[model samples]
Target: MSIFKTKSFWLATGMTLACSVAGVLLAKLPYVNLIGALVLALLLGIAMQVFPQQVRQTAQPGMAFISNKFLRLGIILLGFRLNLVTLARAGVKTILVAIIGVAGTICLTYWLSKKFGAEDELATLTACGCGICGAAAVMGVSPQIETNDEERKRENEVLAVAVVCVMGTVFTLLEIGLKPVLGLSAPQFGIVAGGSLHEIAHAVAAGGAFGESSLDNALIMKLSRVLLLAPVALIIGYWYQRKFVRRSVAQHQPTPKKLPIPWFLAGFILTSVLGTFLPLSAVVLDSFVQAAYIFLGMAMAALGISVNFRVIFQRGGAVFGAATISSACLLTYMVMMAKWFF
Candidate 1:
């Protein structure tokens, strides 16, 4: 087949790009986003899941590509916004805050969820989703969590939805209530929200709610936290690989291979390093950042489209609850960290 002569390819890609455009449009609505367009696109995708037969037949491959490949491209482009000099001079506090917040959330969430009797996969997924970059983090770490049972796989899927949903609600509510309750300054609250919130959308929304400075503070903190995703994945992968190896040896089963570093992390770092020296115009850099948002929206939509709501509700209610609790705890930790840092 000639490269330009495939019906399936055109149809799938066309659908993906169209969805991304819709996402971009929706992002323009006023007061429609305490959440970002990425989340709105996700909601749209989930809504479309009710018509899965048509979607599966025509658009599955392209959706998968956007969620995986395009998402990685966005993460790399994201790096263009960060420079080492900026990171060193102004970002140190935010980076420290992000590290403590993300790292603590992961460990605490995992332990708490297990204590509450969630499955290993459910616990792990919840921790990553809440601890890192919401849907994106969950997607990044997902390659490592292993389960043989059909029920376990389903639990993982439902838990992802649960994590996203809970964070969405909580982060939104926090935007309205946290400052009043805590009496923190805008920058302080922005730091807390960005470090602690589940999705970048939530953090940005929260920041926007406060003002431009808050928005900047929140984004810087959130992106710094995102920078941690690679290290977290490596830690999780190496630990899980070791644990799985020992267990397989005991059961006389073939050991599984260790998880590799996700390629996007490398690209992300490359862009960040290049950004320090690129001297690109602010207009050009802004365009890259804007495009990254669209790509991320499409990726989120792809995940939402894959979910089966009925099955998720029936099988993963308790798993969802566990994730919810884990996130709640993380929010509390984030608030404290923010107050101290700011």
Candidate 2:
């Protein structure tokens, strides 16, 4: 039987299986769960690429749903893992550091995007998404921007996934390999990993690898950063609208649609808060959260496979520049905070 005939089912099955095996393997390793997930995701993508037609026809829609809707739900579920009381305990200073770090990274990445002349929408998406919360940020902002051309929108989506997958993995590797080699303390590694990694899963994985203390610290720091997504999205939308209006006036065209706020973000915050008070069993909570994470990993792997490797290579410079600036700035801020506070 032809694989393309049952593409979606098989594709989902393949990714789900791959992520499960990868997750298990990583969990067993000492301080390497996050690194394992990242590596497995890339390998899965490469495997899909080698069987392009089979993956394209079978997994495309399933992957789309995962990347779009399921990814957002996963992010919201992640909020449950966060402890609001702990966040409060971290106090105003840590919150301030997180805000400053996120804002500064976004600004730096935006500047780098302009410097590189990267595609406007893609660059803005990367800056906000990668700087804030990876896939969740991208989904939150997708509705605000108007990309009338279906092909262009698809290209942008692919590019967004590619950037997230590649950078998320690389950041995980750095968290595992570099922090210890540099003699970073548990708290230091937590701050660095929490601030610098692109996705919550990767951050959690890195922190878990570091140990229990690092895991707790990193999750809190990462959640604080995730909260910045809404404000950053609003800022980007405003900037884009102003630029669009100016260009429209110059060309005598009508203004674009007003940007919509993402309701999922509000839901995420509320659910996280609610989770704090509910006192749910740890087994139940962990089960749901782990399922969501695995789904996200599968989605990311499928999305990464869809990207044309050559195009990624061609635009490698832009992606590299954004990744380097964002990662470096985040690491620098963490180092500064460690010195000042820890």
Candidate models: Cα lDDT each: 0.71, 0.68
lDDT for position 302 in model 1 = 68
- 180-271 per-residue lDDT for model 1 (tens digits): 88877888777777777777777777877888878877787877878787788778877788888999999999988656566777787788
lDDT (Cα, tens digit) per residue for candidate 2, span 244-326: 88888899999776655666667667767877788788887787667656655665565565555565566647855776777
Instruction: Assess the local accuracy of residue 127 in candidate 1 as a C-alpha lDDT between 0 and 100.
Output: 82
Candidate 1 yields a Cα-based lDDT of 0.71
What TM-score do all the candidates reach, one by one? 0.85, 0.78
- lDDT for residue 258 in candidate 2, whole number 0-100: 69
Off by over 4 Å in 2: 1-32, 36-46, 50-55, 58-66, 135-143, 150-185, 201-211, 242-254
Residue 256 in candidate 2, Cα distance off native in Å? 3.6
Lowest-sum lDDT 10-residue window in model 1 = 150-159
